[model samples]
Target chain A: MAHTGKILVTGSGIDLTLLRPLEEAGNSIVARPKLLSAAELKAELRDAVAYLHGGEEYASGDALSTAESLKVVAFMGIGYESFVDVDAAKERGLRVTWTPARRPDAVAVFTLGQIIYANLGIRNRLDERYPPQWSAAVPMPSELSAQRVGIVGLGSIGSRLAGLLLTIGCEVSYYSRTRKLAETTLDLTYRTLPDLAAWSDILVVLLPENPSTVNIIDTSVFARMKEGSILINTARAALVEPVALGNALRDGTIAVAAIDGHYRDESVNAALMREFGPRLLWTAHVAAHTRQSMAAMVDQAVRSVLRALDNAPDENMAVGQ
Target chain B: MAHTGKILVTGSGIDLTLLRPLEEAGNSIVARPKLLSAAELKAELRDAVAYLHGGEEYASGDALSTAESLKVVAFMGIGYESFVDVDAAKERGLRVTWTPARRPDAVAVFTLGQIIYANLGIRNRLDERYPPQWSAAVPMPSELSAQRVGIVGLGSIGSRLAGLLLTIGCEVSYYSRTRKLAETTLDLTYRTLPDLAAWSDILVVLLPENPSTVNIIDTSVFARMKEGSILINTARAALVEPVALGNALRDGTIAVAAIDGHYRDESVNAALMREFGPRLLWTAHVAAHTRQSMAAMVDQAVRSVLRALDNAPDENMAVGQ
Candidate 1:
C-alpha cells in the first residue's frame, strides 16, 4: 500500500500536460496514446495505478476481471460504452469514473459550419474542384434560414448545438425523453421522435450510442423526412441504418449526408462518393479535432486520473454514474 | 434576314436549354458542343446559326476575323473577355452580343454556403468519419455574428451575397466605387479596400476578371487583413496573387482561404492545400451550380440571343457601356 507506482494512461489519446498534477505529486506517468483493442493488452493489465480509455469500442471485461493490481479506470469523454465493464470492475473492487462530454464550443461551431456548407454544397464543390488549377468556385447551396433542424436526444452536447443553430437563425427543434431548462430565445420546440423526423429539413444525431438507440434512423425515419433533406450523424453510425441512409440518398429521398462517425474505411467513403454522386460530403471522422478541444480533452483526462489516485473521487464525473 | 438556315451552337458543355429556345423560336438548331480546341472547329468551321463561345479562353483573331458567314457570335455569360474581336465583328457587320451576367439568387446562395462551410471544415469530417470516432473540428472558428465581412466588388453577385450574409446576421461591409442603394437593415459600411480588408473576418471577391482586378488580393491587402481571417474568392482566381496567397497561408497571416477560381489545373488548390494544410479549402470553379441557377443562366443566354435577333438593342450591355 505504501509503494509508489506510475499512472499509466491506456488507449485514450490524452495529452501529456494533463498529468501535470500527478507529475508534480512526484508520481511517474506512462501514457499510450493509441486506443488499445482487447487483443493487445493482456500483459500490461497488471502494472498500472490508473488507466484512461478512448472511443466507444475497447475491451475491459477480461482485462478488469483478472488485473488484481488495477486501481482505477477513468473515462475522459461521456462515452464509456467501450471501456466500462461496471459489474466486472465493481466485483473486482476497482473504481470507475467518467467526465461527461461537454459540447466543446469549437465542435459546435464546426457542426454549424458543416450544416451550412454541406446543405449549400460547399464541401461537394471542393470534391469536384479541378485538379492542378481552379479558375472559379461554384456553390450549390441552400439556406439555413429556410430549413428546419431536428436534434435528437437533446443532452448537453445536443442542447449546445441547438443553441448555436438558433444563433445562426436556424429554426431549432428537439426530441428527447426529457427536457432541460433552456432559454426561450433559443425558440426550441420539443416533439416526439416521429414528428421530429417529419418536420426536420436536417436531422442531427447527438445522443450516445447504445442498444436502444441503434438504427434509430431506419427506413421509416428516412421516409418521414422531407425528400432531399439531409442527415448529419455526428453521434454514432449505428444511429443511422447505413442501408436505409444509402437507399434514401440514391432515391433522392435524403439529398445529402454528412457523417462524423460510423464509417472510416476508404471503401465506405468511396462508395458514398459514388452513390451520392456530388450529394454526399465526406469528412474522415474528424468532427472533434480542434486545437482547443484536443488540449482540453487531454487536460481533463489526466486530471481525472490524478483525482482517482488521491482517493477523492472525481466530483465532476461520478464513478460509473 | 429572310433565309432559314441551320444554326450551329458551338461550345462543349454549353447548356442545352439556351439553344433549346432557339429551336422553339422556329430556327433549325445544329448544336456542336466543343471545348474551342484546335482539333474540332478549325477542321469544320464550314458546318456552322451562330457560333456560341464558352466562358473559358477565347478563339484566335484569325478564326473570327476571317469568318465569312459567322453572322452572330454570341458570348455565353457576362464577361465578353472570352470572345468578341469587336472591331472585326463590326467590320464584318456580324453581331456580337454578350449575355450580361445576372448575379442570380441561386448563385448567391451557393457563394454564401461555400463561405460558411469552408470555414466549418465539413468535407473533411464527413469523408473521414469512422464509427465510434472522436476528433475536434476547428479550434478557433470565426463566429459569423462576430465577423465583419468585406465584399470587394458591390456588383450584382457581391451585393446579393452580402444580403444573404446579412440575413444570417453577419455585419456586412463593402468597397465598391459606386454606392449601393439596397434596402437593408445591415450596417453596410462603405469603406476603402484596404480598410475593408483590415476590418473584416471574411473577404469575398466578385469583380470582373480584368487587369485592374488581377492580383488585387496582393501582399498589401493580405497584410491589412486581420490575423487568422478567411478570404473567399468566388469571382476570379486572378484576383488573388497565388504566391501572396500561398505565403499568407504558410505564415498564418490568413488563417484559411476558400477560392473558386484559378482552375487551369489543381495548382491553386494544391498550393493552398499544401501551404495551408487542413486550413485552406478550394473547389473546382463551381460556385454557381444550383439547379435553379443553371436554368437561369441558360434562360438568360437564350433570351439575350433572341432579343439581339429581334433587334431590341440592350444599350446597357452594348459595346460602349
Candidate 2:
C-alpha cells in the first residue's frame, strides 16, 4: 500500500504541499494541475491505484473501464455524484469517497451572512446615487432575533446554519426527507415543506441537487411562502426553479431572494438581473470556498485515498465494493 | 404626576401608539411629528413640562433658555450630546435622559453581518459584467471562526458583539477606557489600543463619538494594524479618520474596511468611493435602525419623561439636578 503504483490529482491551484505526506509515504504522484479532458483522464487512470478527483473532469463509465489498476477514487468535494460514475466504479471493485469534513461550517457562515444582508435590505442601496442619509422614512427593519426562519433541508450545512441562527435568537424550523430524531434535542421543530414556507419570515433552501430535489422550490412552493419573506439558496441553483423565483420577486410573493452561484442558463440570470436588480442577491458559488474549508477538504480527500488503497475502513466512502 | 402639562414629541415617524401609555396616564401629548426649526422648537418648549427630543433641532443654550416650564428632556436616541446642551439643561435645573434599551443587540447584529460580508470579499462581484463563474483562482476566504477580532470599546454594543463573535469561535479582545471585571468570565481579553490593533486580523471600532474618542483610529492605529486586516465601524463616523483610512487602503496596510453610516464630509466619501471602490463597504448607517429598537427607544423615552416629571428615580437620566 505504501508503494502504490501512482496517485493522480486533477485540480488547479490546490497547494500541492498539502499532499507531501502522501508523497513521503512512497506513492509516486501524477499531478494534473487543471481539469483534464475525458480521454486525457482515462489515459492517466490506466496505471493509477488511487485517484484524487478535482470534480472538474467527468469520470464516466468508459473512463472507469480504462483504469486497469485503480482501487479507489477520492473526490475533493461533497457532490461526487455530479462528476463520478459511482455504479461503474463499484462494478470495477473501486471504493469511492467524498470530502465533507469542513464544508458545513463554511457554507453555514456564508449563508448566515447572506440572510442578514438581505434581511437588512442593504442590496437596494448598494448603487444609490447620493450618500445615505438618516431618515425616519427609511423603513425600520425587523430584528433578526425575532425572525421565524424555516430551513428547507436539515442536512449538515442546514443544521449548522440552524445552530448559528439559534445563537442569534432566530426561531428555526426545518423540512427534511426524514425527521431527525437526534436533532430534536436542539429545539428544531419539524415542518412539512408547505407548512415551513407558510410559517417562515425567511426560507432557506439547502437540499442537494438530485432527481428528487431538482427544482424542488417551484411555483407551488412560492404560493405557500409568506409575503415579503426572504429566500436564500446556497445549495445548487437547480434546487430552485429560476422562473418561479423570478415570478415570486416580481409579484411580491417573497420580498427578496439571494442565490449563490450561477444558474444553468446565463440568459435566465441576465433577464432576472435586469428585471429584479437588488431584490435578487446573486453571487458566484463561493459558499464553501473558504481557505480553512479548502485545506481540510484536501486533507480529508488525501486521507480517504490512503485508507482506500490500504483496504482500511473510511467513513466518507460513498460507494464501496 | 398623572396630569403633567404638555409632553411634546418632536421625532418624526415614531408610531405615536407607543406613547399611548403616557397619554393614558393623563399627560397632554403635544405632537410635533417633524424635526422643528430652532425658533419653532423654542416656541413650543415655552409651555411644555416634558420634551421628547428627536436629536434633530439643536437644543442649544439659547433654545433651552426659552423653555421656562420644561422640567425634563428625554432624547430619543443614545447620542444626546450632539443635539442637547446638557450643561445648559443642568444650569436650568432640568433632568436629561436618553433611551439606550434594545439598541445594543440591533447594532451588534448589523455589525456582525458587515464583518462577515467584508470577510467573504463579495463586494467586487456586485457589478460583474458577466454571471459569476467558478474558478480555481478565486482566493479562498478565511473562516470567521478562526479570526482574531479586536474591539475598540467595551460598551454595551461592543460587549454584545464580542459575545456574538465568541459563539462563532472567534478570538475576541477589547481596548476600552477601563477593564471590565464582570466580562472577564466571558473569555474576553483586554489589550491596549495599539496592541489590539497590531494583533487583530479584524478591528472593530464601537466607541461613542465624544471629544476624547474622535479620530482615535487614525494613522498611528492604522500603522499598528496587521497588514491585510479588515476594519469595521458601526459606531459614529468620526471615530475613524477618513483620510487615514483612505491612505491605509491605498498602501495595503489594510485589505478592506466597511463603515456603516455616512462620514462628515460628502466630498471625502465621494472621493474615497471613487478611489477605493469595493475595498470600502459603506452603508447608510442602519445598524440601530430596527423596528424593535425603535419601539423600545420610544417606550423608554416616554417612561423617562414621565419619571422626571413625577420626581421619581430614573436610571436613563444622563444629567440630573
Chain A of candidate 1 compared with the true chain A, TM-score: 0.83
lDDT of each: 0.64, 0.81
Query: Which candidate wins on TM-score?
Result: 2
lDDT of model 2 at position B45: 88
Q: In DockQ terms, which candidate is top? A: 2
Give the alpha carbon lDDT tens digit for every residue of B205-304 in model 2.
Answer: 9887667888999999998987789999987777889889988999888788888756656787789889987787776655776778878888898889
lDDT of 1 at A36: 52
For model 2, what is the error of residue A11's alpha carbon versus the real structure, in angstroms, after optimal superposition? Answer: 6.2
**Residue B121 shift from truth in candidate 2, angstroms:** 1.4
Write model 1 residue lDDT over B1-321, tens digit each, in one string.
322345656543345655667777776776654244544554444444455555454445556654555556666556565345566566667667665665455456556666766565444445443332333434434445446788888777777677667655578889876777742444588989999999988888877765567788899998888777888888767778888888887777776677765544446656566656566566655555444454556666566556555656553244421
The digit string of per-residue lDDT tens for model 1 on A1-321 reads 222466666533344565677778767777665545565554556676667664444546787765666767776566565347766777777667766654355555556666766676565445343322222233234456557999887776676778756644578888886775653546689888889999999988877765578788899888888877888877656678877888898787877786765442347556767767566655544455444555566576667666666666566554443
Candidate 2, superposed: residue stretches over 4 Å from native: A1-13, A19-73, A91-95, A126-138, A306-315, B1-13, B16-58, B62-72, B92-94, B126-138, B306-314
**Candidate 1: lDDT of B211?**
55
